[model samples]
Target: MNEMQKPVIGFTCGDLNGIGLELILKTLGDHRLLEICTPVVFASNKSINFYRKSLPDINFNYASGKDFSRLNPKQVNIYPCWEEEVAITPGQLNETGGKYALISLKEAAQALKAGHIHGLVTAPIHKKNIQSADFNYSGHTPYLKDLFGVNDVVMFMVAENMRIGLVTEHVTVADVSKHITKESIISKLKIMHSSLQKDFGIDKPKIAVLGLNPHAGDEGLIGSEEENIIKPAIKEAKHNMLVFGPYSADAFFARGQYERFDAVLAMYHDQGLIPFKSLAIGEGVNFTAGLNAVRTSPDHGTAFDIAGKGKADHSSFMAATFECIEIIRLRFGYAEMRQNPLRKMSARILANAVDEKIEETE
Candidate 1:
């Protein structure tokens, strides 16, 4: 693709002390990545040079710019967000690292809103250190929700063919049950359904909803959430799309049931993440669905323990970059298809008839 045709992907330097820059440098170092997208790193030249000096094996060369007007497709571009002198202590957590991380994120978010960049790939951030008077959100999903003026979003994680979404993210286990209401379940299902069709390019997506309790509450023996809230929400959601089961989380993955569905919705964070991480491991990417703009991040965290060791794997970060680009392209195609309402309606009706016939036979 040419310079203008290629998507300009913006990267946020998450916690300077963490492996955020390391992953970015390592992924972009391959040179072949530039052919797919024009990368703009939202950090100062000083930070880039610091990492380059430390890891002399990697090549870090890019054009320095504050905007996307002159993005070089052949070379990575450094968008100067913070130019002040800062200490570089890799693998240590501090307030200064979080401060710079937010600065980079804010700059890139602004550019994203102004239509300068097509998509955003955020590195992991230290949630506690990043919190300040100006930014007080839990993580990137909520932060981007408020930034884009969206009411709800889904924290969808992808690793190859396995796609898992959480109904309640980053909340305590005690609060998770309270948040798993019928409305919330339905809302998340809607987001997941739309994301599958528009972002992942699935025509008719099948989603499995996991229950809040063990054995899916054993059909109300252990907990009433499956019978009361989850089932009701799934019933209502089926009218719009194909949704099935408040399935037992353990057997769902253990028996390879996740392979049968396009996506799976877990009631809480760990329920979805534990299995996904176990299966996908170094290749998972977290995609924030239901946003006007495409935003993705590595599935793992800041990795403060392995920050400076040069041992942090870049596979997940690379997957996030590829996901962002693919989602951007898919969204374009989805928009074009949506422009014709008659065609969409015809397809929907035909699909429903086929589903009805299959149900009758079964």
Candidate 2:
């Protein structure tokens, strides 16, 4: 039997003033999670402790030092990005919170880049506050894309009921049409198709594409994107994948049509997220698909409304953390699956050669 491989997962403190660390602490409090993977959190010790006091129920015995050479496998490990004390004012959105959140994220990302960690599970970061000269993207999807030097990636929302991939995310509603093209649709479809196979372990996945307009453009009366751009793209993808429909978004979800397929590809953000978040009901995970590494985050954002009330639900955060470990395992299994085909092909060739030799001798 093969030995168990517990992946080293890196967790990033998204916003110092938000519930990011609160969720992380609650999830890591359970000793059962430590057996599956070693966690490395990128945040200051002061920042972690500040939240720990409020969450009296949680118990996370951790260690930190100048380096990660001698990490304890059974406890949470903190790699402090800032040595000096940080002023963490919970339930407030300020420049200090954004600055330190960026610091933690960059540190965690660098560790992930250098192969120090196997996967990343990020806490929620406020988009507007986390913007600057160095980080001016709409979300982590684009930032990681540019950082990893990847050409394209998909913002895939995963849940127990359905999985949704967006063609255009964080784009203005008015400009959503300008971004919709046959090529872009096909590209997102390809990424989603591969992710379902490798990341989610779905073989021969059936993907459904949603329309861009109401009533699916009423056959081009309301909008022409569905007929002109989306339909042709689905047809092109059908040559290689099991892709179907520029279905009307409203009626599709209203009648539970998403259950008929493995995944649904939405033209824009709300088209997909509205149904996904409603159905996920606090258990959704936002996975950045098509990157070289694995990353997942809670579908919900920094709930500034309920930041430090001790009322924050950690289910989505826990789901994201557990999903990160699962995807890492699935990816290894997928790599082994790819190698098996070659071995089988080689054996078949050898068998055919032996049969030819026997025939010649007879």
Candidate 3:
């Protein structure tokens, strides 16, 4: 037995208007979820119960703050962020919901640092709906980073067995080039590398880097970025990593070459995410790597239109939960090999076939 103690994971309800609340409620309805790890939701109990009653065939016997210690994995536990008097309407955005969402996130981050919880899995939050009274940071990642005063944070989405990390995020398309400097790429790469090795338990992980230009700047004809920017950064970063490319973005994903590397470092958000979402939409898990504490969320955003429709899919939420466990295991030093079990077997099979081919030639 691994004897690895089950970790307590914190959940943040993102935007009340979005399906974040609905998905959180649905994902917890699975009674078997408790057996894997203890889940603590940081949201209002009123919102939670209202959603449960509104949806049919959904049952969550959520434990409140006073009843936290008595919590068992077979049931759900919720840490109330505000009183029940607060009125909440499905598909409505308000300052109250924004305040509550930020409160939950702050509390969860605190609990993680205090060792009260092992990791965190946040529900989707609306960036625009949130008001200044609750938060001043750009996004959850930035807020958490500032709260912890820790640098080196990266966001990656996992789905279809592909992990993609971004060099720039949450900015206009025009600003992407200016942000793609050697320092920026190097910093993001460092974060990605450490996350894969320490938080993801990938020893000597191979990273695939993409070019900023089309067809990798077509040898400097189409764009100068490949020669002046990306290539030089890769050259410097290579001394500390087994990194490859400045590969053409168009063909790298199409040829399935990305699977060869532990992670693909894309120069911009769309550069990496277009292919990722295309392959893993609705099932992709968004992971915030290189944080002091583990945090993940569904790859998609809050679906305000589908908030109370009972139509939101919980697949991405489930993946985020499972990915949290994997990260927990990695941090605890339980992942023994660089390749996960499935990947190790595949590597062995490929090596054996190659040996047989060589023998035949001899």
Q: Which candidate number has the best TM-score?
A: 1
lDDT of 1 by residue, 72-118 (tens): 88999999997789998998889989999999999999888888999
Model 1 CA deviation exceeding 4 Å by range: 1-4, 340-362
Q: Indicate which candidate wins on lDDT.
A: 1
Count of clashing pairs, candidate 2: 0
TM per candidate comes to 0.93, 0.92, 0.88
lDDT of 3 by residue, 151-241 (tens): 7678777775778998887878888888888888888889888887777655566788898888888889987988998889989998997
Model 3 segments more than 4 A misplaced: 66-74, 334-362
Cα deviation of 35, candidate 2, in Å: 0.6
User: How far off is residue 68 in model 1, in Å?
Assistant: 2.0
Error of 2 at 64 (Å): 0.6
- The residue pairs found clashing in candidate 3 are 34-73
- lDDT, residue 69, model 3: 55
Off by over 4 Å in 2: 1-3, 342-362
**Which has the better TM-score: candidate 1, or candidate 3?**
1
